[model samples]
Target: MLNKKAGMIAAVALSTSLLVTACSTQTGTESQASSPSETSKPAKQETLRILSGVVGGKTPEENALFEKEVERLTGIKVTIEKPAADYDKKLYAAIAAGEKYDLIYMGKGNMDVLVEQGALTQLNDKIKASKVLSDPKVIPTKEWDMITYNGGKIYSVFNKSEGGTLPTVRQDWMDKLKLQQPKTLDDFYQTLKAFKEKDPDGNGKDDTYGLSTAGLYDIQGFMSAAGVKYKYVMDANGKRSIPYATDAAVPIYEWFAKLYKEGILDPNFATNDSGKMRELFLTNRVGMVTYWDAWVGLFNNMKKTDDPKFVAKAIPGAVGPDGKVMLRRGDPSVWGIPVNAEHVDTAMKFLEFWQSDKGNILSTLGIEGTDYTVKDGKYSLTPDGISHGMDHGAPFPNNTNFKNPIGTLPGALEGRQIIFDNNATIENSTKDWPNAEKIVTNYAFQAMMGKMPAADAVKKMRDELKAVNLID
Candidate 1:
């Protein structure tokens, strides 16, 4: 029986071996018959993962059209997401956790930290190699320096030369009130008083505030009026002092106290972020505000339906007592690539494409018929296009090769001058920026709400800074 079983097993093994060999021979023959050209496949398209704060709260479907257009133009797929309201914190966690994001849209504050930790890729070599990128016309050397690290290495690039929170008032309001352009801080206050008391909207409703900033901190120009340091106080001798420690800050607190207690400022100043502020202004609740100049066109364009006379213009910053009007320079809308990120080459290519005229047109103007129309060679934004907010990444692009058909929007020029002339550099000099800001913000709120004397607040701020070794 054992001998019979062994003979049967041998026969089965031989059959299996023969079958396997026959299959292999057939496959080999088929493979040999096929030519490289006949079987060649196209390269797999690369996909980039992006994290940006700009598209916050946007539905995937809402973002899909613009993203699809960008993908079609660049031949690279991109996935963008805003994971949290505190974008910087989210980004910090991502970097800490070694998440592989191909592109990161960040601010200088967080960029500094990422650069310090060697989390960002060195982009200088790549930028220089690209045809249109890093061209003096594309982005000036000074602007590039904002993202340059280790003195000369480029780790990031800023999209636009940002003009900061500007004093934008309703042109109709000024005309209706018959008020002159406010040239000084006190003059501005008086204008605010009139705006609150008089119905500039002419609705016969006392529903307007003198000023409606996104936040108290965003009232940056006014904060600097009394020679207060919104950040670092630089003297004629090139000495850096803490703004909170100085007597100049007392008047700033007092002025805000007046605005707050007297109901000249927004009632919801504590809770009103940029979004709420926008609603307040659009609904005819705010007479004046300090916001990004870029919104002048969009806001005016949007409000044209309700109020034809809703002409909003950004005025020169109200001159301060120290013969200065400190405002923020244009935002450094900086973008970066992470070290060892997937599709690095593709990411770089996409960035270069973004700065190109075609890409610029797409991002700046949106889909030709959808976002804008070209009638007789003149490009005008359609209402839907205007509201689309389609800036694939370069919302405020400054490409020399691309002459934007949309030209300069209203209040943009004055905003540029006001910012460039009075660029008050905010202090990020401390090892911990958030801590410094927190210390100042807390004291400022107390002073503004009349919970403490401005002098006492300043003294406390100075003492705190000293205790934390933030000041000498």
Candidate 2:
């Protein structure tokens, strides 16, 4: 009850934070000199209110920069309120009350719900008029519209889509074992067998497992590599049906059960979350783990505290069941500005700055000389990299040139290159693989709950999807 009350209070605070305002009079040297005829020139000075989840520690400095640049370009005052963890709860309350906010930064799923409820402003007309929607590289309009509500009434800009797993192994251990990177499914099995039997981590005990994958979302990473996709129910003549009683999902569970029985996989994976998995990796208890390129930064950061020499690298590829290289899923972009504002002109100006060569660099890279500096052709920041984490500093200053900047965060050395290679492998291998969405989603969580056989779960999903006409 206490928790619920706290949540409600937090939600109220978030929704109303920017709604109530104490209006202020505007006085400017330039305003006094304006021609009398210019008095009707749209409201020249207006305030725009925004609600967001971005933590703001260094925000004052960045806010100052934006304020100066925005006012000089368009006469508007922007007041941004960014909440932290309880953001979702607060956002929903505001939506329920029809609270007004000029802009909002939110998640894809919630954005969908809000759009359906008419709580969000549609930017279709504004986007077309602005002409930024025409640039494919800048905004992959069609693909990103999947994130929009019906009729492409875009509510938010897509951020970045990432889906691929780069399984990082302990190279030093592999070298000690005289093993070449496993190229075939059989070879991978043998490598795991050896890692389990031969003591790969070199602590002289049978502690390290050959592979570690959790039962939650991480399981999909492994299954995708094995060429499986899972979705929920399907439609026959537009009627929904279950998918956990299918043939396609059976093999997945069978394989996992085999692994579980073999002792090559960590037994506790049925409940391991990312943080727990990270703990396993950091302690060097697991030989390899499935992760995206972002995990590399975490591993790199770990080097400073534990072992400075504990470097991890992505192998060329991992073999799927068909004796072909495999990769994981893809995520869509998730960032953009809204159009419901008194300061629409000024907001548009800020959007231009964000996408502009100057704005792009600032958004991604950070202030020059402070966040990073250019050397030769590359931009570099230290290992302990500066955190805009809670510090709402302005966008990075040097990252504007690359239309599509890859990697988890900006300024990680060679980070984008690594992501590119991983993405390419996933694209190539999964090109011909079936889009087994039903089997993927249905049986996935079963593994997490230890409820049913992974194979049974997958097969059930396939049958169910097929019954409702999901498979061709």
Please provide, for model 1 over 155-237, each residue's C-alpha lDDT reduced to its tens digit, 9 standing for 90 to 100: 87664456566778888889889999987878888999999998887788888898887555466677667655455555678
Q: After superposition, how far is residue 325 of candidate 1 from its true place, in Å?
A: 1.9
Structural similarity to truth (TM-score) of each candidate: 0.84, 0.68
lDDT tens per residue, model 2, 1-472: 0000111112344324544343444433336768655543233355667665542223556555544444444345656665544666666776565566666655554554465555665666666676554466655545554565556567665433343445666666687789888755456667767777888766788888877765433344344345543333335574433222344445555655666678877787767766677678778787777665545555655554557656565553444556544344333323344333445554555554455654554444444455456787576663213443211222222122354232343223333354454433222111111234424444655643357866656566656556655554
lDDT to native, each model? 0.69, 0.51
Alpha-carbon RMSD to native, per candidate = 14.2, 7.6
* Residue pairs in collision within model 1: 162-330, 162-331, 163-330
* Model 1: lowest-lDDT 10 consecutive positions: 1-10
lDDT of 2: 0.51
